[model samples]
Target: MVATTASTGALPPDLFDTTTLVSLAATLVLLGAGYAASRQFLPKDAKNSARVLFVWHAFDALIHLILEASYLYHCFFSWIPASSVTAEDLGSSQFYMPQPSPFLGHADRIYGPQAGAIHGNALAKLWMVYARADHRWAGPDLVVISLELLTVFIAAPMAIWICYDLSMRRSRANVLMLIVATGELYGGFMTFCPEWLVLSENLDCSNFMYKWVYIVFFNTLWVWLPLYAMYVAISEISDAFAVRDALAKVKKSN
Candidate 1:
């Protein structure tokens, strides 16, 4: 795959010679949509805190469900016989497939997130661009698969639930946010730390777009927001406890 990936061609030349701009624009548009939903649907007197929570989680649900789920679809559905794979199989898309890809070496079929490069599948190509940034994403890396499974299935619905809870003023939103946000922080750690321990072998840091924007900036979106979610949860939990304590003190005094 490496022998031919270079010969295949360069990344798409538009949007900073990469799909970075496209992905970023889409993210901002989704986030903006989320904010608009909060403004239009959430009650007028709803706290800014709830509005913010609603917006972020709504964005989270859309990203995880629509975008990230395609990754799983490629992994589960996309394939070709490796024995018949050729240079023409990998076209103009710049995603790499490791020479003797660990997943393909022992199989008759090759399955990867790079399916877009292989077959012109547009949805699969979305991830293939990022796969150029991180090679682990190019193939069926087990750790990545496991993490994505949790992300698409569990975290996504949890995000939607958080949005509903925020809109309804449910106290359970605090616990849900705390739990899922902690899991998200853990998810980011597990996704990268194992690679770090290996000196980031599968990570391609050869360019600013791949290194800074894709790896650092995009991935950290999950981290930074989850930290904020945890803070919000902890603060509300503490406030609830304080109110309970004050009420108990009044009852005892009476």
Candidate 2:
């Protein structure tokens, strides 16, 4: 039942390959749910762009609330002993441990973000599947956790607000989209830039699914979507400014 690997240790990918397929189906289901919601929640008069934004933001918010939040949960509550001797003393605590454990060097204490597979924590395994792509997901990596904190608590609510604004057809939706999009781009950059600068030591890109689908394509969405949002926001704002200038000229002429 080992889920994550080539991170702290090399685990058999074939054994857990089915987990990847299952999680992929679930992710698609989550994404489809967002689009379905747009039909119900968005107004008929709403533009196609609004509909797309609504679906994307809704999916983003849910990811923060559901999947990412679950990661935080395991980080906070899941535990495994750092010391082999401590693990022995704990007794019955080691039903399914991570091989080449991230916590092994620390010794004498419990560490987490690696939930026990014995408990049948499907969500943890889902993350572990992704952790195989990026080691940072397998343990308590500070940068990832900090970025996720903002992503979950702050970005999640902002994304929800954007969805609400899009549904309501409010001008503030543009502003919110601009803000959230900027934050997302910044988060995406910070998440990977350092790793890139350090030659991507924490990343495993050997697998096609891990490299193309999970790391590249998934991360690219944040970049592309946010850039589009920023464009929309700036365009609308510029139009507003032009209108204001035209009105000022009319007043002076009168």
Clashes of each: 0, 0
TM-score of each: 0.85, 0.84
Top lDDT prediction, candidate number: 1
Query: Tens digit of lDDT per residue, candidate 2, span 1-49?
Result: 0122243444444534777788888888889989998999899888877
Using TM-score as the measure, the top candidate is 1
Q: Provide the lDDT at 180 for model 1.
A: 86
Q: So what's the TM-score on candidate 2? A: 0.84
The models' CA-based lDDT, in order, is 0.76, 0.74
- Evaluated at residue 47, the lDDT of candidate 1 is 84
In model 1, the worst 10-residue window by lDDT is 1-10
Off by over 4 Å in 1: 1-20, 86-106
Cα displacement (angstroms), candidate 2, residue 192, comes to: 0.6
> Any idea what lDDT model 2 has?
0.74
